[model samples]
Target chain A: MITVDATGLSCPEPVMLAKKAAKDNPADEIQVLVDNATARDNIVRMSRGVSRTASVQESGGVYTITLARP
Target chain B: MESVTKERVILIVCGIAFAVVAIALAAMGNPKNMAICIACFIRDTAGSMQLHTAAPVQYFRPEIVGIILGALLMALGTKEFKASAGSSPFTRFVLGFCVMVGCLVFLGCPLRMVLRMSAGDLNAWVALIGFAAGIFTGVMFLKGGFSLGKAAPTRTMTEGFVFPVVALVLFILSLVTTLFVASAEGPGSMHAPVIVSLIGGLVFGALAQRARLCFAGGLRDTFLIRDASGLITVGILFVGMLIYNLVTGGFNVGFAEQPIAHSEALWNILGMYVVGFGATLMGGCPLRQLVLAGQGSGDSAISIIGLLVGAAFAHNFGLASSAAGTTPNGQIACIACIIVLFAIALLNLRKQSA
Candidate 1:
């Protein structure tokens, strides 16, 4: 598993980081941490491009997005 | 801690600066409630380039070029420029085209939507609701499996620099060529001086670049996360323009007889719906596309090309609306665009989990 803490980063940046992580770690589940809904939503969207599923969990103002192939 | 404070200050400053400069430009004769409309300005630029012969709206807006150049300068200075492209370029083009159709039909982009509301054009409120509805719908798609594939890094940094170079070339071309013509009358003929427009564009571009300002993103965040960090700019922007209009005696409140706007309530709502929806699919607003181009995204450059082409098609085919009202063809086109966007959404989705 690869983890990325993308808290405080804005839209395209979070999306880009998620894309990079997904590309680098194919076959492994990639996890992303984001603070805002926009980042969480966008990262979820980007994950669909690289993987089959992205399950998200939110806790105390932070979202954890895990990307995995079906 | 210091960086966070600095970012907050910059955001507030940039937001205020954008509002003040836009209203000031409008007062100085750019257009009422249209100090900086990416779609209209781009359409005007197309006319200036003689891509379309719509006599009422033709002029090479320096602000458009200035935006790219300004962003380029910031990116270069900060060494944050990364040239990337090749993520569903044609779909982006189609989205850009449809967005222009919607904006021209509504007579404004997202920026002008806010400015018009600030200027007391009540029609903008309807468009706002429609925009919000469209965004809500698009967010539903995001929650589904819709995706536009990832943009890979370009082989060379020079590939990213192409957009800036294109901006420079356009600037030079505007200076030398009568190929680019100014309008003799109508919205096309009315404009602030070229130098002022350029300066305004540069300031807005630079500030928006640093602040990462996006009108659509603001609304999206508000709806999705219940966060208002982006929406804060929207509020500040409205407040700034409200003060500017009141002070300059430009505040006119009414639905009918607003300058350069149509009162066809349904079309106005539907037109902006297309803009809000298409912008969401493209991952940013029209202004955001220009900024991304400056930052060396070839995909954005392609999307900008799509915008220019869309503008040409809109004017040439009578798909754009006017002060009188939306044309029958324009109305049909707006509805068709919404359906097409839905189709795009459905077509791009991954299959459901079994």
Candidate 2:
């Protein structure tokens, strides 16, 4: 599992980090943490391009998105 | 200190500084309620270069120069500059141009919108409502996977030096004074002292760079994430401005006779609606764009070019509004920009195919 913590980073930063995670761990499940919805949504969209399905869990404004290869 | 606390403190400091700088610039002579307006200053700078022949609004503004240079220097000192580009260059340019049209229609960018509203301009209030509505709409687009794509990192640093170099040239020209055209009368002619304005811009630019303070993104995050971090800073700035205005007897709440503003409710609303939408599409406000350009983003530099050209275009084509009211040409341009914005938004959307 590749876990990417994107809390506190703004848009495009989080998205870029998520992209890097996917690139480096091509066949692994990626778990991403973000503090906002926009970054979460952007990461989820990026996951789709990599053929990964994303499941999100939220608590206290923090979102954990797990992207798994289908 | 915790990271969160540190970030919040930086934001608060930046906000307070902005309030102080805006007021101080005005006191030192940058037209009343006109301090720190990115669009207006760019327009004036364009006029000074004879990019447009507007007689009353021609002046080489040093604040613009100071801002870009300040951001560039801070980013460099902190080793945060990473020059890159290639994310929908033309689309970003159009969005930049369209946003400037919207700003001219309303006579202010987001920063000046706050300034005008704090000083009791009802037109700005109307524009605020439209800005919020537009942000909400941009949120809908985001939900549907709207993005400008990723910018690839460049190998060389030369691309990132563009805006900084421009700022340096402008700084020297501003000090030389006679090198550029100066406005004889009107809003363009009114200005604070060159050194004072540059200092204000430098302070504002450095703080804003550190905090990533953005007026439009604050609104965008408000609608998109239910996060108010960005808005909190703007709120702080507002309260600061409000307090200063009230204490100094500058506050006069009314629908008429506000300085540098018009009362056409619909255009004011639509104008900012376009601004909010375009800023969202491009990511960041006009001020943010300048900072990003200084940070070595060539894409943002292209956008800034569009802003300067758009400012010239608005004045040359009579598509900018005045204190009297919205011009017929300006009204048409606003509507056209809105249509073009919708088109860009729809065209750039990437649909996922499984």
Candidate 3:
């Protein structure tokens, strides 16, 4: 699994980071860390576009989303 | 810090350049008190679409087409062109709709608010103050963690170019129609020709992109972070446009007889208040959204669509304010818009778990 931490990032950064991580490791699972709901949604939508499934877990303001190939 | 300084310098230059181009365009046939207003042009376009039967204002604007095409070229050259969408599209639509409703009530966007003030409309002062106040409210929401989510990337570039393509088609249609139909009287007849407007738009677009200039962002940042870099550009634009207007004898100094504006002070302030608040919440003003859309932001594109539809609704339902003043229905719509926007903001506010 490839881990990309985008905590505290806003708008396009979190989505951009998650996209980079997923594209770089197509065969592995990708985990993205974000602090806002928008980033979480963006990552989830991006993952879905690539035919992957995404799940989200929240703790405090931090959100952890994992995307994996199905 | 260096990056910030560079950004500020670029913004200042762009603001000054915009003022100069606006004055020149006005001298060359663009309407008095308005050289480049995205909202006004969209309002005109809305008329052309028969969404509103406002006869004198209907025309296909070349400046808008130029803004999109200019930005497209710059993006392509810099390889920043990427088509993407995934943001909460429906929410953006609603936001855009609210934005237009608010702006039409005020008779201008944030950019035009400043421009109107520069032209000596004391009414614009009220609107500007209201805009700042509304942005302040939006800053409060941001501090409490309000967001609209991010946009996902798309594989097809065609999706990204949809707005630009439509703009191109409109440009073609404008040319074809000119052969058979004369331009409408008043504002529609006054234009700087397609080439001049396009060039002006290109210059403005490039400078704005480099500086990240946004009137709504300026107010939002001032309230949220106490940063004044963005506000400085706004200040310069106001002063510059004011001076230019005076030199050109365009300064009117009153609410009465202002082009495309009404004398209704309360609704004017309230209208901009809604626009300021909604734009601040959505992260940018209408002009800023257009620029962002040009930069391949799907959320902004959705917002633009909302703006178009909102303009349609406003005219169709007789909700748009006029030079005489806002209709009773327009006033009612303004009140309803405020309540709805505030409700949305309240619902989106982050709550502490007790």
Candidate 4:
């Protein structure tokens, strides 16, 4: 599992970070931590582009997005 | 399915409102092909404050005040009002400043660019290409992990309320023409009534806040991740304008004799390129910045200040293009801002996770 803590980052940044991680480790499941709904939705949307399934968990205001290869 | 339908409905209503308001305001004398330009209005606002002594564009615009206040009202009503601020302050200021410079070089913001196209200004179509190129470049940077960090929550609500309060003051001052300097001619002098501007701005602000509309966001999302959903509003807006113009006999074809626009293709392209590039880095366009400020973003408020000062600086330094054509100074500034923006983008890229 590869973890990217993007809790303080915004959209396109978090989306891009998670995407780069997935690209670098194609066999690994990538998890991205974010802080807002916009970032969460955007990251999920970006994941869809790469044919990855995104599952999200919410704790307080932080979102942990797990992107798994199909 | 119900929620998705609701979202689409909201987007449609917002798009229709923008088109109708834009045309109505134009008819009411808000300048041809420029019913609601945040960049232009704010530049004129700066001139009204004597930020720059540009005589032709000097006037305090009430629409700006309405937009800010209207956004504030909706935000507060929705319980989303925040003291959300403290991002990369200076960087955003510079970016905002650069965005204004870019917009002026092209003679309009994304909204006015669409409006200009609707009015059959071919220059706007050329500018659209440049804006896309710039957005494409920014998307490449995003794919490489480009970011300006994040905004921290403000310590006090007072910081957030400042923008709205100041806007209220400006709006009040706008009613008394003697208190503020206004142009007797030029675009500044041509305006809808003070009440019309305020009410129009308020409606626009509330709708924009609700819709979360950002022209740059639409283009950026489309370029970056192939998400075209953000573009529903823009598509609707353009179609509405085209239909309205055709029916009302407002359509005038060709680049020459276009109102408040120039025919210099290269500069028009380069200018909007700067706007698209800078706004993408900043996460929104000039209009979005104003709405963000009204929603209590100190960072956006600073960006607004940057826009105000930048607009003034453009006029003072002759970096602004006019209907006559792109001036030499405007040309130099366009090239310079592009170089500066690229350097900023390169310096801010982070490849590491977290």
TM-score of each: 0.85, 0.86, 0.81, 0.91
Question: For model 4, how does the per-residue alpha-carbon lDDT over B107-145 read when each residue is reduced to its tens digit?
Answer: 999889999999899999999999999888888887676
Reference-based lDDT, residue B337, model 1: 93
Comparing only chain B with the true structure, the TM-scores of all models are: 0.96, 0.97, 0.93, 0.97
Would you list the rank order by DockQ, best first?
4, 2, 1, 3
Among all windows of ten consecutive residues in candidate 2 chain B, which has the lowest summed lDDT? B1-10
Candidate 2 Cα misplacement greater than 4 A, ranges = A2-70
DockQ of each: 0.08, 0.08, 0.04, 0.43
Highest lDDT against the true fold, candidate: 4
lDDT of 2 at B150: 65
Model 3 misplaced stretches (Cα beyond 4 Å): A1-70, B1-4, B177-183, B350-354
Task: Return the lDDT, model 2, position B207.
Answer: 71
Candidate 2 share of real interface contacts = 0.00
Better of 2 and 4 by TM-score: 4
Candidate 2 docking classification: incorrect
Best by DockQ: 4
For residues B23-88, could you state the per-residue lDDT of candidate 1 as single tens digits? Answer: 767867797788888888999999998888899999999889888888777767755566778778
TM-score of decoy 1 = 0.85
Residue B239's lDDT within candidate 1 is: 93
Question: Model 2, B184-295: lDDT tens per residue?
Answer: 9999989998889999988888777776778888887667644567776788888898898999999999889999899999999999999999988888889989888887
The best candidate by TM-score is 4
Cα deviation of B280, candidate 4, in Å: 0.9
